[model samples]
Target: MSTTTAPASATVADAGYGSARRRDPVLIGLWISLVLVAVVWIAPFVFIVFTSLKTTGDVMTTGAFTPPATVHYQNYENAWARGDFSTTFTNSVIITFIKVPLGLFISAMAAYALARMRIIWGKLILLIILFGTMIPFQVMLAPIFTVVNSFGLIDTYPGIILPYLAFGVPYQVFILHGFFSVIPRELSEAARIDGASDITIFRRIFLPASIPVLAALLILDFVNTWNEFAMALVILQDAGMWTLPLGLMSFQGQFSNDYGQLNAAIVMTVLPATIVYLIFQRYFVSGLMSGAVKG
Candidate 1:
């Protein structure tokens, strides 16, 4: 006499149910913590956008916590004009467009050389570049300013751009070099055997394969260049030549106490960087980590 066994379907269902029942408390706590953290990060931006729509008087009297009685759509338009964002935005556009491609190409080439080429003292050169990243930009301000002034580049687009390019290169090289190292050397040898030069191999083979890392660099560098204030403020003395960040100081005046206007200007000022990040954010994350993990 033998006992009957449960059906396979029933056994599977019971196992699944048991497994599902054993949820980890730590994971649940982590998810809860993440939600709280997300809320904490997002709350200020929500407040800024809502507060930006309120009238200046409403901001002063009703307070930042209070919602606007009427949505002031004109605040943005007024802020745009008063902030001189039209000129400043053009300057930002010019700087970003010129510097991003230039910086990315230069960094990629340098990274490719350091990663693949058998150069004399290559490690020493890489060490120098890495060391550059560790030094504070503020610390170099004096020397950078002196060089810019001596070259008579101050208050010009190139003046701000040169410094940004110089600062940007080492970081981009560091990241791109990591990605380049993981690439198969066989590919370069194959291309070389096919009579491809170093530049052609880099342009055709390496550059195409390194899009993720490049995209990450572009997004990061764009944000850094856009929001950069201290250097721009120091280098750009002419109001007409100011970038958006520098132009934002116009919102603060001796007589005007318009928090709403200032907040609206801030919203406009941050909008481009926000849109860029949101659009490329996925690439930004994946590309940043692509170099870290190797097969």
Candidate 2:
């Protein structure tokens, strides 16, 4: 049978109409808003990178927002050497590695007990722990200092790591509790039936299932411990024990600050944290979404 198709002009008109009809104003507005927010969020980092690349003279003459005539890559090397970052970076790494694993392990155990086992005043205990997280660390700084001094741990790694564990545990417990509570009770019961101890079950079953949430917790706690300044400043008096944040402060001086070197240090300081977040971001998002759902 012979067939007749619509004219080219008619087909073109229909395609245009369909395209226009599918365009939603709300979605367009949302995209525009996101772009704007991204620009605002990213502007400071861009400015910092540009400033890091410029010579001190260019920065004073042209301003921070302007692109550099030539990228001054040596600023990073200079900053690292001048700031004594090698020592600070090592201290930060040691503290983070020790504290993050220990803190996560402790918090996970507490969360599992509260979430899966029958215990007296478990809710009350959990509530108290949550309250600990809510209290500002600054309020306890003086007392913490006194206690650390009493133990003669001042200017030592233990002084900082101990406090990080104390402050970090409560929040980690809170987050892990939410994720753990939503896990199927039947899984644990089946493991129990098969002769698995609580620790064994936690190690084998729960830990595997909890990877996403654990990754999220790791990122959060790592960033917090790594970037923590006030506590490190107060607890660590020795130059040998200073963390990256404290070391960065050394770049600033009374008469003249090395803006170029300082900005380079800032970029280096942020790089590790940024890389960590990027690595775990997928798991972090999924963990957050799962935690938000009602158990």
Candidate 3:
């Protein structure tokens, strides 16, 4: 048979056309939008890093975005001591660590009952939870404070932790219930057939399979409990019992603000949250993707 071949120029042109068509316009636009948004979002952090290195006077004289000619490592040291962060960081850590685990366990139990077991008014309870999430935390602040005060729990770890658990549980339960409901019923049914108790199945089957979900929630609850300020402000009046957020108030004096120390403190405050987010970033993203795929 006689051979017939296209010119190299025509082949190259055809390949280029195919490659251009493969780059979807919508996807390209989305990437551009995301890059622009990321730059805008990161601007504040960049400004803070720059400001933390500058002196209070320099902040006024120089622009917000300007880099410092002389870096101030002293700012971190001053902020650490003046802020009294040791006590506050310990208090915040204790509250967050204790509350996150307890909250997760409670939420998982509730979600399991709602998702897997039959119970009277379970759907109604779930509906209530769905609505409860929409209610602002500010709405419950007065009642929570009143109850904490009545119980003489002010300035105690339980006072703050209890409220955190109460507010955080509903959303955790909602997410867990959705994830649990999508899991195959046969797994639990078979475990039941083998004479396993509900708790056993929860521990052995459901929980083991829900690692990504649990890890994501763990990170989220930890961050929330750590960053919570309003409830802590209302509950913890004792300086020894204050959390990091409360400790930040020390930066603002009656006459002037310590911009250097304030920005440094802000950076310090972000460290733990950023570390946690980085640690669980894998599970967080996977868990969300799993839910999206399942749904």
Candidate 4:
């Protein structure tokens, strides 16, 4: 009797070939979708960057999407000088740094209380907190302005930050509460059994575990604070105290005829937030799942 068998290498190769062929359609579809999405997402940024390099005449004659015949580097210089970006940018940085961490700390503590501690009317308090997220920004504008004016805080950093904190805290509390809810109660109990205080457990365990979510929130809050125009406009009447957004609005009138310089200002306005996002992008994906819970 005789038997024939395929060689080991041949068998392995055939299996791999078959698997790849079976997956070919899915892989091709995935690649196509990614390419399409990338092009769509990048299109506006490309348009802005290209438009920013064209003179006003180039912009008008060459059409919106057309590349400039001659690159204009002076647009950036003109934008920075005319927009007063240096001072406005510094103002934004100070405000964002002050508010984001303060908001996060307050939110995290509020979340810990709601998720971990037993208190009278805790659920009622949480409902009120969650309800704050639903209120429209416009609706709060008058009240906030009134409160700030009554306290004589207008044109000051505190005037801007206090209202921002009030508007921003509810959302942070909502998210942080959801995340803290998923953290098993047993972990806190175990720490308590070992004589760890509530603050100790929070600082040593919860905060360390929550770094990814906190980092994600840090970037979001930073962007929001940086780009915030309405509140800044309402609170900061003094030109010297204006943030980037307010500066941009006022500067837009100066560059009305110069689209290149206008777009250059836009780029500079968006650049810091973009840089912050790129720096913290790794944590963003994992932190997105922070509020999910067990079935």
Evaluation by lDDT, superior candidate among 2 and 4: 4
Q: Go through the candidates in order and give each one's C-alpha lDDT.
A: 0.87, 0.88, 0.87, 0.89
lDDT of 2 by residue, 267-288 (tens): 9898998999999999998877
How do the residues 227-270 of candidate 3 rate in per-residue lDDT, one tens digit apiece? Answer: 88898998999989999988876555421377888888888887
TM-score of 3: 0.87
Report the error of model 1 at residue 209, Å.
Answer: 1.4
TM-score to native of every candidate shown: 0.91, 0.90, 0.87, 0.88
lDDT of 4: 0.89
TM-score, prediction 4: 0.88
Tens digits of lDDT, candidate 1, 83-173: 8789999998999889989999999999999999999999999999988899889989989999999999999989999999899999888
Which candidate leads in lDDT? 4
Residue-wise lDDT of candidate 4 within 193-285, one digit each (tens)? 999998999998889888888888888898999999988888899999999999988889877778899999999999999999999999987
TM-score-based ranking, best first? Answer: 1, 2, 4, 3
Q: List runs of model 1 lying over 4 Å from the truth.
A: 1-13, 60-67, 254-256, 293-295
TM-score of 1: 0.91
Model 3 ranges with Cα > 4 A deviation: 1-19, 22-28, 57-63, 254-256, 289-295
Q: C-alpha displacement of 176 in model 4, angstroms?
A: 1.3
Cα error of candidate 2 at position 2, Å:
19
